[model samples]
Target: MQIIEQQIKTKLSSSAKFYGYIPDVSQEIDPAAERPSVLICPGGGYVMTSDREAEPVALNFVAAGFNAFVLRYSIAPARYPVALLEVASAMKLIRKNSAAWHVDPKRVIIAGFSAGGHLAANFATSWDRDLVTEYGYHADEIQPNGLFLGYSVITSGKYAHVDSFKNLLGDRYGEPELMSKVSLEKQVTKSTPPAFIWHTVSDDTVPVENSLLFAEALEAHQISFELHLFPKGGHGLSLGTSATAIKSNGYGLEPTVSAWRDLFVAWVQNNI
Candidate 1:
């Protein structure tokens, strides 16, 4: 609940600006310190990053006995490959400094919502293919243990999340094969890490089809994936705090997240 520590400023790419929410690791560094780490990317349609998305989500992980790094990662203004490379670079830095940060490099996870979710999905699937060089990074050097996508935009150009694609990837990304190239659903393979996704059917911003489609891909690949589709609540339901949204299942966004957090940690313990 306190800003006990921080990585004041950092670089995502040579020219792009980015920041991260590296929580206070001093509090949990026992003699046998070991815990999963998460990198949280927030939604801003790729145009901007929601600091709230990065900050609050990290704190929640900290509460769950994990070291969380919240990315105030760059936005659409900086463009696609830039944001992508930054994520890879950040993962490298975190992995290199895992000892000092008190995190287990093997248990790193990439998580995000909406456009941020798209990036998380991209990072997961495209770790081996940073095809465009604007954002310079060696994919072989960085990888995450899993993905946590919240209403991710997995379909590229054709069925793309119009606004998010336009803002983050530019209007040009909407061009046929380009959208499919970036679509995580289209990119899925047996090698993809496990994933956890949640979205509401009522979300109009990115549409539920996004997650459902990607979920189908995960199923086809025989990958381990978990999904939760809520009945109501619209886009940007960050904490599922919607007045009209029902919590009758005893798993509203907030409570549901706590359970998922446990599931995530357990999954890491078992898988990683």
Candidate 2:
């Protein structure tokens, strides 16, 4: 396996980082193999990127036979399009190096946890917008073939994760137009990719409605999606297993929710 790390600099923030876990293929194996990839954005309510959702999640995907990349996107104090653009940059980088990296560009997917899910969804729905095109990336260059969201923040209205929006929009938090724009459920379109989303109904932090709203919109648009609402667990559970448990806190561990990873891998195989 090959490990790659690089600082991803964009017009808005220079501190964002990109980490890639690419498996090394040999002639003894399948020399012409080109693997599907997952670009992950770890959530932190737009304040920080959670370590629990970074490498561990990537390693799991790598173990599942997919190349994985993690984007520690810029958070708080850096508003709106900054992190979004950084995501675009990461996608652009991935596709730009797809051949050399042995990646099947058509099978590239974007996965995010919590607020990072918002970023991934935003990019999924708004990839053709002027913001990304203005950033010098063609829509196709940054398009994700599929979306995988984990306990995501998907709205800017009633069920919104207030802090995530506050940090994302900064002073523009309450600006109705901007808020409505970031209310990703309303942003879904025919162009948006199919999605595999999971959230625990017991989550009070971001609420399961966020995922419901996005799924509803996807349905309304006639887009394909698979949503799982677990009966137990809280927000930011990451893998919802001991591996993602924080310190002595086992609240993140939910045996039922841990099945999401395997379900997502199956979804990728069947859907993406």
lDDT of candidates 1 onward, in order: 0.70, 0.92
Error in Å for residue 119 of model 2: 0.7
Query: Pick by lDDT: which candidate is best?
Result: 2
Show where candidate 2 strays beyond 4 Å: none
lDDT tens digits, residue span 18-68, model 1: 344444544455655767888888888877776556666676678777777
TM-score of 1: 0.81
- Every model's TM-score: 0.81, 0.98
What is the clash count for each candidate, in the order shown?
3, 0
Global fold similarity of model 2 (TM-score): 0.98
**Candidate 1 Cα outliers beyond 4 Å, as residue runs:** 1-12, 15-29, 131-140, 157-159, 241-272
Cα error of candidate 2 at position 242, Å? 1.5
Model 2 scores a C-alpha lDDT of 0.92
